[model samples]
Target: MESFFEFRHVYKGFDGRAILHDVSFDVRAGETVCIMGRSGVGKSVTLKLIMGFLKPDSGQIIADGIDVPLLSEAELTQMHKKITMVFQSGALFDSLTVFDNVAFPLREREHENEAEVETVVTGLLSMLDLNDQRGDYPASLSTGMKRAVAIARALAARPKAILYDEPTTMVDPMMSHTIADLIQRVKRQYKLTSIVVTHDTSLARKLADRLIMLHEGGVRFFGTVEEMDASQDPVVREFLQQDELALP
Candidate 1:
């Protein structure tokens, strides 16, 4: 499979502190890659770079064959149509109902037909199991529900790739499972190129086709779950051990 996203020797920093140095990885077309690391390891920063929200100090950041950092504002806007990010906060419009929130992307395309918007939004809501809450506002929804609605909105854009930022964070155990399952379903259903940034090992196990573990601003490990489990690296084993200890 061809790469849909690639980062070569990417470096980023904030306030004179380096976050990522010589970071490199690639996500293949129609593949799901999970990025896991401790807090402050630049997991989210990687996503921002891919979205062109931030440019690397040096190195290539490519998404769908386009050099993301080199894209102009108008060019980036067009690129955004093909790739979408589901923010950790859900980022729902405070005043919009669930239906309108999901319909927002389609409406932005200037589709004059309300019926098409209804069809698309309803289908996405149904797929994400948000049909019952479609009339409600974001404030009334639980963290998981809000994330679900955010995903519905992302799907509404008909993006070829979707970047998920901590999808299972701050949600209950059951909701976490539900969210992970939803991500899996979306992957199988849409064959989307996906990049998920999370610290949740369980979520990573459930959703990752390949995993990239970052440590100290670089990739510590990159491989499948089996390979990760067999890794003898103390840092990798320590991270996995810590995750196990945290489980109830």
Candidate 2:
């Protein structure tokens, strides 16, 4: 199997404060890896780096055999289509209706016809059980529905990989699990490469094929769920314990 994404000896910082130090990892096609950490431990930064929102201070990031740091403007445009991000806040436009929100990306590219757009966007919205809310604006939706709309919008581009940042945060208990299940089904059904960044181990356990934990500006552990459970390291144990308490 080919590696779809690789972070090699990456070091990054802002204003003399380092967020990542020599971090290295590779995500293969169709792989789902969870990057978990305590709050403010650079979990979101990791997602941003993969999305090319921030340049690393040093080292290399390779996605689909293209060097991210060396990519020209044209190359960056192609890379943008290969990956998409699901933000923590859902980031919907209060002004746009849900259907239009999902169709926004398509409209920007000017390639999809109304029928084509409706077919694809409606399918996505229906998958997340938001078909009836197509005309509803973000202001009318609940937190979970807003997230579902955001997720549908992200998938509108048919990206090869998705960077989900704190996908299940700040939702009801039932909705959280429902979203987790939706994520699992979506990945398998679409054969996607997913990198979910969150400290929520319960969600991680349900979705991750491999698990990685970051602490103190480095990857403290990278392994399977069984290995995580068996880990006797104080930090790993503590993190998992906290996760257990977080479950509904």
Clashes of each: 0, 0
lDDT of 2 by residue, 55-149 (tens): 89998998878888887778787788878889999999889999999999888787678999889998998898888999998998889888888
Worst 10-residue stretch by lDDT in candidate 1?
105-114
Those runs of model 2 whose alpha carbons end farther than 4 Å from true positions after fitting are: none
Candidate whose lDDT is highest: 1
lDDT string, candidate 1, 104-169, tens digits: 989999754799999989999999999999899999999999999999999999999999999999
> How much is the lDDT of residue 198 in candidate 2?
78
Query: What stretches of model 1 exceed 4 Å from their correct place?
Result: none
Model 2, residue 104: C-alpha shift (Å): 1.4
